[model samples]
Target: MAEDQLMTYAVGEQMNLMALLKNVTVRVAKNGKQYLDLTFEDRSGEITGKFWDASEADVERYQAGRVVRLTGKRETYQGSPQVKIVSLRLANADEPHEPGDFMIHAPMKTAEMEEELNQVIFEITNQVWNRIVRSLIAKHRDEFFSFPAAKRNHHAFEGGLAYHTLSILKLAHSVTSQYPNLNAPLLYAGAILHDLGKVTELSGPVSTQYTAQGNLIGHISLVDGEIVAACQELKLDVNSEDVVLLRHMVLAHHGLLEYGSPVRPRLLEAEVLHQLDELDASIMMMTNALDKTTPGNFGERLFAMDGRSFYRPSEGLTGKVDPEK
Candidate 1:
């Protein structure tokens, strides 16, 4: 059967399937026998598999990013589904294998999200800030549109960086619209550039890991440096009032020092940006949690959201009226 259908495998059912090896780890049992702990994946999701008493040669053959044909029996472990492997081997060239099927992507289409982002960009009016923001976007447009906001947090799928930024942009626009005294240009720039560094922070959209630069500096400081470099390229004074304040907004977008922000929000716009950034992230996290839950059951605990579990109702919550009535 197809890999995507693997998640539906019932307990004790023996099956054969082709899947991507998302991860593999070699471990020793209490008896000192080597075993393979593996994660197999397709577009639907991933499942854990254990190949017990694996030979050293087999361990070397099974690695992440390889396509494998495996025989396994489905089982439940600790309330999650997994597979018990009987045997497996690398797929031959003639096998039906497609790498794209194993990758997760954002729900929104890329081009549509880009259009929304450009509309937001067009609304920015502050001359210098607009130039700096546009220059950064132009420089990293490809990565910006494709990279995940994080390896395994909010907006972790492909194109998630752009999707998360656009989400915050809409939130910022609404917040600024309600409070006219807030600076629209600064808010927009902050929303757009707040997570710009994540493009470099994360390795990529699939099987993400941190790069050395990501570990050393992080996205906040990295984006701050990007802004500085952009200002230098544009021949603008880096220490000018607008530039400094914009940097402050990016640096303080995380809202607190404990949460990764080098500084807390000081300016009113900075404070607003921090709130909007958090609001977008929190909503996405909660929504993702809900998506994984059954209609009448509780979702798994979300560590990022303070270990909260959400209840999913059987009925839709949109409050849409029935037109047929």
Candidate 2:
């Protein structure tokens, strides 16, 4: 299908197109019959669908990470767009499209991201922090750049983990410049390494899911463990103030105990890291919703943002206020 044609079907319109099987789960209905809960994706976006009365063979054939041709109707279920699957079949061997063709990716190019990351690392003048960050990043380099920051929500795409990190670093740079008292190196290092745990937290890019460790131990604690292990391997004292502070950055990034942070942000840099992380993620979520919303309308309610919907003002409205004469 042409790029323009992707996801352009009007509600109730029937569509037959190739899409990547982003996710597939066997679900049991009240009637005691099994069905496939499916998520289909193309470059445009994703939609959920239901394939009812599925057989064992159907489950095996419609696995995630494969491209399939599906016939379905565009629909609204509880205010969200989904598909009512009429039929679905695996793509033929001769089909031109592949799973990679439908995978979403970070906006920045990999080379550009790498170069920018290296520049940020160079700014981590603290010797211990520099070595630790360099070592962990080098060790998990591929996964760090390939895994999604999450299974869903903000920055959930190929290389999203790294992209989100870089975004926070950019924000931290400006914040540190204006506040001068904030330690630039500490904030930068925290930003780079804060979500590094997500590489371990989430499975690879294709059909992303949370791993057992992610569900149980969680990313913050997992990364803190990694920092401790790295210290052991690198022969650095884990008890040192530098190591403790670095660990605290990751542990307190979620901002509160209820939100998964084991501790609150006691350090100024840790507080800044937490705030910047929230700021970047909030911006991404709101921007994504606004992109799909028509001008002068409110977008969908964002669950991550207290179930609030944002408005996209019509073009040509001056956002600036006139100064008093």
- What CA RMSD would you report for each candidate? 4.0, 3.1
Best by lDDT: 2
Candidate 1 lDDT, 22-139, residue by residue in tens: 7678999999999998888766656788888999898888877788898888886644468988889898989866666666677888899889988888888988889999999999
lDDT of 2 by residue, 1-325 (tens): 3233336777778888889988899999999999999988887877789999999999989998999988878886644568999889988998845788888899888888889999999999999999999999999999988888888779988989999999998899899889999999989888888998888888899999889999999999999999999999999999999999999999999999999999999999999999999999999988877765657978778899999988999989887987983
Q: What global local distance difference test value does model 2 have?
A: 0.88
Model 1 CA lDDT for position 224: 98
Score each candidate by Cα lDDT. 0.83, 0.88
Q: lDDT of candidate 1 vs native?
A: 0.83
Off by over 4 Å in 1: 1-3, 6-16, 23-37, 48-59, 70-87, 315-325
Report residue 1 deviation for candidate 2 (angstroms).
Answer: 11
TM-score of each: 0.85, 0.92
